[model samples]
Target: MDERFEIFLVATPGLEAPLAAEAAALGWQPVVGPGGVTITGGWADVWRANLWLRGATRVLVRVGSFRALHLAQLDKRARKFPWATVLRRDVPVRVETTCKASRIYHAGAATQRIERAIAEELGAPLAPDAALVVKVRIEDDLVTISLDTTGESLHKRGHKEAVAKAPMRETMAAMFLREMGFDGSQPVLDPMCGSGTFVIEAAEIAAGLAPGRSRSFGFQQLASFDAAAWETMRTAAAPRPAPAQFFGSDRDAGAIRMSLANAERAGVAGLTRFDCRAIGDLQRPDGPPGIVIVNPPYGARIGNKGPLFGLHAAMGAVFRERLQGWRMGIVTSEGGLAKATGLPLESGPVVAHGGLKVRLWQTGMV
Candidate 1:
């Protein structure tokens, strides 16, 4: 029987269910956990998960597992597990370990133990910041080792050449759209759309564009990665034509320019209409009531919270006065700022984004 490897969909803890649903949509049976979801799949499935999962921060493939009672047994077994299958001997690797209720509770010392074992037994070189990293976890006498198939977080889709102040990540934007039940049909608007991340992600979704189509991943360096198969998959997953269904505006002309450039790079510029306008110009598009998602600046970046209070008040007034019955999703780190909207929204799940605890308060179901 072919070995079924464990695939982990790493996220910011609260989004595990949404990420799991995305994985399951791709035909992977995802078992949701606290911080991520685990599934059993082959090498090809692993590649698909990384390439297509818009909500996952990273996809880790479990390489091997065993019961190691002591440090010696871990070192001995680590040597025998054929690291060459996934890691090249010439390429350096960094060992990271996490222990919980296990014999090896000291993470730093345990990492050193595994590092020395690989260097001495397998002749693998160790670097301070290796392109490849092996993550080891010990829980209840069970040892599970996984390789970081995604060197950096998958959210770095490699397209945004520049970023504005307080920009949102592509993965988080896509997940937010999904959470708001975006089906890629209705017109979506992002007032205060800095660099157009939310609008661009929505355009990509509407056009069936693969998130990783224009990027490179660490899996390309692995020995087990089939180049021909990957090429075939890439060709098959090329971006399709997106209907003109995305709109966005920012008060800053610089942000609008950046959004246009990013949209051009993503090849969805024609599908999105970004303007150098403010929230006052926001009007209902030519369609059924659509979703409006915005990530406005809080006190952290822009200015004193005192001035921002009036801005939030105006935002609430505008939504109620003009955009009645339209779904509104506002991402804000400050609860007081969100409350300033006064849109009958007192509850929403908290999301950790960019080191800030954010909430996606939605009101007026479309």
Candidate 2:
């Protein structure tokens, strides 16, 4: 169970840099790549990665790899794999395959071969909807097999049940916070706080709460899982006080309601505040000015940027007049809309979100 292997932390495409930085800060030797970060460790490290990483979409363990130029070779190699050491015979498993510049170019055929090998050789039941997934990649005649150790996506967080339209995922929100130089000491405010993602994420970080504290992961279903050891690791994360307050507001009363509910479910309601008001009514909180981040409507889906541009300009004016000392981060798809903020902003990475590409613009000080 302590066999060292490659652990891949899947990032949200453009957010790979921040995710790698986070892994490095956690004392892991993170190697940055295109879609994720790579670290090497054993099963305990796998559990810890699932329990600690807020920016990761999922965690995968590369258990084995070999050269298989054809379907028969792939089948023979997969049958010879030590699946019993990594996968349970009783737990249902799903196999997904992909081919890139490889001799085994048919993904469906590869999937069938792997599934047959696991089912007949290892006697593990195969199901399409299984929680435990075995991922296969045939790239350049090399067959790489990995296990999806983090199930149900880390963004679920096992807390918030309700979500608003185009709501930002918790993982993305967290990485975005890291990009803005947040260190849990300064307050965070989100005016268009749909479902209170940013504010609640900030509060959790400030309070030293593990993002995966309330959730279950796919690693628990693997054969290598040790229940007692996992319990110790999961329960080791202790919470601390959030030094500064977090604030969220929205013009829609229902949005504010959702925000309040989400904050409460996330156990950060006491440290966070949600108000129903227009952006114009936003006033800087009494304490020290901290950071203001907003995910305004991109208007790309609506096919209209006229009103959105005006809204951005108005929001910018309100920030200039009201929240004078705070820094700002604005996320939107339209360059026109972000520029309309009229703040001295520098552009960050372009991230893929819900089929649309969005960029984060950061300002030094309002």
Per candidate, the number of residue pairs that clash is 0, 0
Give per-residue CA lDDT, model 2, range 124-233, as digits (tens): 99999999999998899999999999989999999888799889999999999999999899999999998999999999999999899989999999999999999999
Task: For residues 1-366, write the lDDT of model 1, one tens digit per residue.
Answer: 145788888986567777887788788888998788999988888788888889999989998888888888877777677776777767788988999999877788778878887787667799988878899999986888898888788888878776888889888888888888897887788988989999999998888888888888878777787899998987796566657878888999999999999999988899999888788777766766788898988977666778888888898888788777778888888888888988776546778887678878777663
Q: Local error of candidate 1 at 135, Å?
A: 0.6
Tell me the deviation in Å of residue 100 in model 1. Answer: 2.0
Error of 2 at 241 (Å): 1.2
Q: In candidate 2, which residue pairs clash? A: none
- Give all candidates' CA lDDT scores: 0.83, 0.92
**What are the C-alpha RMSDs, in order, of all predicted structures?**
1.9, 1.0
Which parts of model 2 have CA positions greater than 4 angstroms off?
Answer: none
Clashing pairs in 1: none
